[model samples]
Target: VSDSGLGFSHNRFIALIVSIAFLVVLFEGASELGGGMIKAQVEQTTSKFHPEKNAEDRLKPAMVLATEANIDNSVEETSEAVAAEWSAEGSCQQVIEGNDMLQFNLKEMVVSANCKEVTVTLKHTGAMPANVMGHNWVLTNNTDFMPVAQAGGAAGIENNYVPVGDQRVLAATTIIGGGQETSVTFSIDSLVVGDDYTFFCSFPGHYAIMKGAFKVI
Candidate 1:
């Protein structure tokens, strides 16, 4: 099952990369096309009003394109900063993001076993309410993951879809909606290094896609 999940994650990652690349190509082409169209229109207007001047002399639309390019760069940088903030791992603190798409931004999380306590932050980046597209971070042994998740479903959203007072729940965060964030901290003393662990969402029908491997080293 773990292997299958890994395979699915890997394939999804590849698909996402490909889709992003395609989008980038389309966006660049559209930007260029738009700039060219605007420049041509400006040049035509200039030539029509002042035919004595050459086409090169009337082409003054480059400034607008330059400004647009600058704006694009700024937006790209801001996006990278947000992604960096959420992708943090490899320490005592881990950050993860989920959206209305029923997906987690990461397929694996790792922490150092030396840390006394570990913190996990879950950020919902979509535009949905908690009842519709709620997400939470749940940690359990690999063997207990599915069973706990199943029981959690019966426990309802009031319990963050986690089985109440269940020892199998190593850690879990409260369910959150779009634009909301929640976190949970658990002691690392109960965690064993090199053991099979898994993290998932306890939301009904979401565990299948919103799950990942958890590792301690």
Candidate 2:
């Protein structure tokens, strides 16, 4: 009698497994009712245990389910900070205006490493002719600035007052006469963090007076 009862229990267990497998197949075959019933049962169990978790907890699935998802947010933040470190890489946008008196309104500009390309716009607010008081924006390492400016003066207005093919020239804008404006966009890959850079007007005799610091921070 005991053996017969054991055999009956084994048969029932096999039947239960077969029933579960069949239900899984039905759910996979697009049986919405079967799938919904399974989902409802699981949700009921989840709510019973996690009754305190509300809408706010549900909104941030990644944050709330970090353990379940096995994600590390600290690493993400660190990567972002490293990317923004100006010394590693960066770019900037600067705007400077010149007047008939040969003066730049800004004495300094700052660039951040988050940018891949920087753009500079030079506006000639003065009404003077390019021959008399033309203005252009030029950038170079601070140490080479005086020499480049001297060479650029000789290079003349035809080259926008800048020495042509000068590798020291990080970026330069076109020479503009009064009431005209120009802009130049260049990569920041060559710029290093904390390096001293100087921006000046390469127009004849202007660099001596119109110059400022370019900060990469």
Candidate 3:
């Protein structure tokens, strides 16, 4: 009975050792798997946030954004420059007006010498008839302004208040009444740059007050 009890205890001891070995192997395998999973997760997070793997991949988007910003700024500056140039360099066509007070709206008229032909639009914003308070736009040199105006007054409204075949008259628009509009096209070849010129209304005696400097530059 003593031998049998000893054998049974030995068997139990061997079984316990086998079970312990199996448990150790299982735990080691589980640890290795968990470590591998953690390594993979860390790598994935680093690649997503810190993409310093390739220089091109990191800087391409930034470069594109900067280029677009530069292009937009260039377009805006170019537009502003073009607008300023247009405002400084007068155009070939202009408009002027005469009201009941016998005053021209523009104190000075600017003309571009580069224009082949210049057009002048005149509007009568007065409340009187042409025969009563007539207004006609006449262009002449400063030297011939008074004489041309006098001759035009003598010409009368029948001839649009402009002398017939007068060489001193550079251009003239017809006499207009209230709410009337007239325009005249004249060649720029006859205009001299830096020369003094005068534009006035030759309506009876309205030249003195209704005149302005006409400049060709």
Task: Give the candidate number with the greatest lDDT.
Answer: 1
Candidate 2 residue lDDT tens string, 51-164:
476756666676668744432453345436544553423336566788997777766667776668888899999999899989999999999899999999999888887888
Off by over 4 Å in 2: 1-91
Q: Work out the TM-score per prediction.
A: 0.60, 0.58, 0.59
Residue 159 of model 2: what lDDT?
A: 88
lDDT of each: 0.87, 0.81, 0.85
Sliding window of 10 residues with minimal summed lDDT for model 3: 81-90
Name the weakest run of 10 consecutive residues (lDDT summed) in model 2: 82-91
Which has the higher TM-score value, candidate number 2 or candidate number 3? 3
Give per-model CA RMSD.
29.5, 21.1, 20.8
Q: List the residue pairs that clash in candidate 3.
A: none
Clashing pairs for model 2 are 90-113
Please provide, for model 1 over 144-198, each residue's C-alpha lDDT reduced to its tens digit, 9 standing for 90 to 100.
9999999999999999999999999999999999999999989979888999899
Off by over 4 Å in 3: 1-90
Instruction: Report, for all candidates in order, the number of backbone clashes.
Output: 0, 1, 0
Report the error of model 1 at residue 167, Å: 0.1
Model 3 residue 80 CA deviation (Å) reads 19
